[model samples]
Target: MMRASLPLRRGMPTSVLGSVSANLARPSSVLAAPSASKFTSLQSNKAPSNLSKRFYSSKTPNEIASEAQADFDPHAITAMDKQSPPEPGADFNVVIVGAGNINFGSDEGPWNHSFRLEHKLGPRLKVVGLIDPSADRAEKVLDVKRKSFVLSAYKDTIVYPTFADYVRNRDPAKPPHAFWVGSPPAFRGREESGRDLEKALVEAFPNAGIFIEKPVSTGPVDEAFAIAERLKSAGNIVSVGYMLRYLKVVQKMKQILEENNLKVMATNARYIMAYEHTAKLDWWDKSQTCGPIVEQATHFCDLSRYFGGEVDLDSVLAHSLEHFEPAGHLRRVPVPEETIAPEQRIPRITCATWKYTSGAVGSLTHAVALHGYNYSTELDIIADGHSLRLVDPYNAPVLYFRRPGDDHEEVVRYQSDDPFFSEVSNLIDNIELGPGSAPILSSYEDAVKTYALTWQIRNRSEEQVRKLGKGPANF
Candidate 1:
């Protein structure tokens, strides 16, 4: 078994970061600026107070790639780029709309690294502004030489409160090039900044591209569809936060499925994290975060769909365990104060079986009360009189087999320099080259499917409990 460990540390090697900075410092020479670009020249206006020459000029390509590969076994970069070399100095300006942990900084923050990688990749990309409600959090982006402003308490900063506040306030000839929405998922009886961000993007910069975080919402499916329709009508290119879709390992798995001509029989996925990591927040409760199925397990569900093909649930069954006393000394409460009985908390364990329209059967299981923030994601596929298993996400290799007579395991490792960097680089290339140039791995359609699957599991579980006349119901 591959030893699982967190990828981030305070004093871990800064070589990659330093290399990225060096690349940014090098002048842009790769791609020519778009003649019809919407973004105004920063030189024309007094650059945002936070903007600095250092931020723009960071690292060199060789240095960035070298640092990215230092952590892993040495592999030739050419092995992964046989098709096409990455486009350099592509001009793509971005306006990030949320300052969440995933996008800005976190223990294993892909977004944080992605931003730096974008700088190294070329001048085609720039983060111009950050729009978030919390002033403190917004200040983080402002410190990076990007404009930061508190968004109004309205859905879609562009339409509800009027786009003139932010857009018209600026030069109309040059609008934001793109909007990146990294807000948390909207919960039941709670605030939803994503909807607001989407509205703003559609109204203020209908022609700009957009990137929204996952688990789009906790509400009905129709709402998400409506938002998608609006984006489509506005001629915007919207990408969802299904980052795994761009991972090299995931791509290999897809290739394996196609090469084998296999049919999926059953799939099992589990994600376990430390209770201390999740239990402290109000949104940790299943109802608030749209249940474990939607909030946490949706990624695995999306993976299952990717491997197993189109998933249409025939039925779903679920159960929950609440906090209770062993000797009747303490009565379990639905919502605890200060501390919660282990049992009374949200269901630590969840299991569900989904029957796809293609006649494939699949299962999903997950838990969040492990010893530490240790995450294990696996997919077991039984088909063609054989079995294929993918255990542990970060390091586990794919295991495959042929039949009762032929049994073997072959490791499937990323043959690339850095999968995460490759993901961001591809995103930039797609935007620069336009449609058909690069693959669009993650789409709003896939996100919708994942969201609906999660909703089905959560809603079905609550309905089953209601039918059984059980207490401690979920909202």
Candidate 2:
């Protein structure tokens, strides 16, 4: 139970900004006076807050230089109009930005996951354009067509080194109708808060439906909210990639809870990813991936918020553990030599707990020390007279249920259901049915709260380590 002094906004739903303290700036909080650089000077030896502020400011030097270089006759139709409903079996054009792990598989080369969009969406969603900072990766992605891809459709796909290049060279008459932003969470800004991808997309294709991947950002909350507001104002059909919410077992769990009218009292979630299977060294570093809580275990964190509602930042507390030594458990998995050079380290395990303004408690445990490919992820929700459990949502989804006095537990399993593909289908449906008609399970604004909660966990864990002076050691 919360202390009497803890502030609570009466009758307000607790899931959205429920954990936000009255003293903290709200999501709508913007800088009183904008400047060229929204960020304060980067502090030395400080783990940056997840909710960093990025104010709307005048153009920076780099932006100005880039604009000067790209002087051209602006298209008469600067922005694409609200798309008319697609005729029967018509193909919708989509521009894919970023060529990282989420866009492609985490295998040896860039093409491993390159054709995922085509494999999943196929001819219905044609790839009209591609953008990435890496020229080679972008070229490879456009050139490769993996199994089950229609050969003829990809012939017209165009590649660009940056969003600016795409805008400059793209046939203004054929702007993309939608976007798939699969860039890393930290790829948003150059120095401060910036949504270069979203800005470019809106400039090229207004009212275009956009699907951005999870952990909306690696920066501060101020910038995340600002980016969200920009997308919302564009009237774009936006959806964040929280695909776990679409799992069949998860849906069934919600149905059972709602139909039974069970009031949730607590939520417990765990995500132990296959540490040995992670091929990318940057994924193991905190500066790059923001640790497991924000990077890998975020799906479970999002689920906790989904089941328990929004979190209260004031009620949050966290503990983390990291160990790297010869013959230690850290030796079991591959660690980059540079990361263990006594100046940098990443947490191997993190456990965080927080309360919802709705008076419910929630806890999440995430670890990156497991072996093999079977990700040990699960969520348990305890409500009035009953409890629910969902296991391994990423691969195979399973739900277990038990009533307070029931003799046996009920089990339901979903076979071969891909939530990623389902999410894409939902995005296409939203485009087809038009905005405000088809439902979007997770929007940018909705997912930012989940991102904020994860950041709270990270910030608290770092503070605890600092206070202890020897909690989690650097390499």
Could you tell me every candidate's TM-score relative to the true structure? Answer: 0.70, 0.76
Q: Where is model 2 poorest over a 10-residue stretch in terms of lDDT? A: 1-10
Question: Once superposed on the true structure, which residue ranges of model 1 sit more than 4 Å away at CA?
Answer: 1-90, 113-117, 144-164, 187-196, 324-345, 394-405, 415-419, 473-475
Candidate 1's TM-score reads 0.70
Clashes of 1: 26
Tens digits of per-residue lDDT, candidate 1, 1-475, equal 0122212111101111001001110010101111112111210122112222222133322223223332222232413334343365434556654444444555433335334434434334455554444445456434543333212111122211112234545545436666655444341101234224465557667667776556665445545545555555677666665655555555555455545666667776665543443322333333233345665677778777666655554365655432332321222222343353221245556677877656888788866444554566677777766676766654443444445466666665655434445445545555656743444455664566566677666656555545666544432
Residue runs of model 2 more than 4 Å from their true location after superposition: 1-88, 104-124, 146-149, 189-195, 324-329, 337-343, 471-475
Tell me the deviation in Å of residue 413 in model 2. Answer: 1.0
Per-residue lDDT tens digits for candidate 2, residues 1-475, read 0111010011111111111111111111111111212221110212213432221132222222123222211111111122233244667777776554445443322222234445544466577776665556656545564223455456777866566677678876666777777654444522242334565566567868888766666556655666776776788888877766766677677667666767679999987655564544544445434555765566677788777775677788998775542322465566564554332356778889999757999999887666655557779999988878887665556889997789578998755555555566567767877753434667776677677777778778767767878643531
Candidate of highest TM-score: 2
**Per-prediction count of colliding residue pairs?**
26, 10
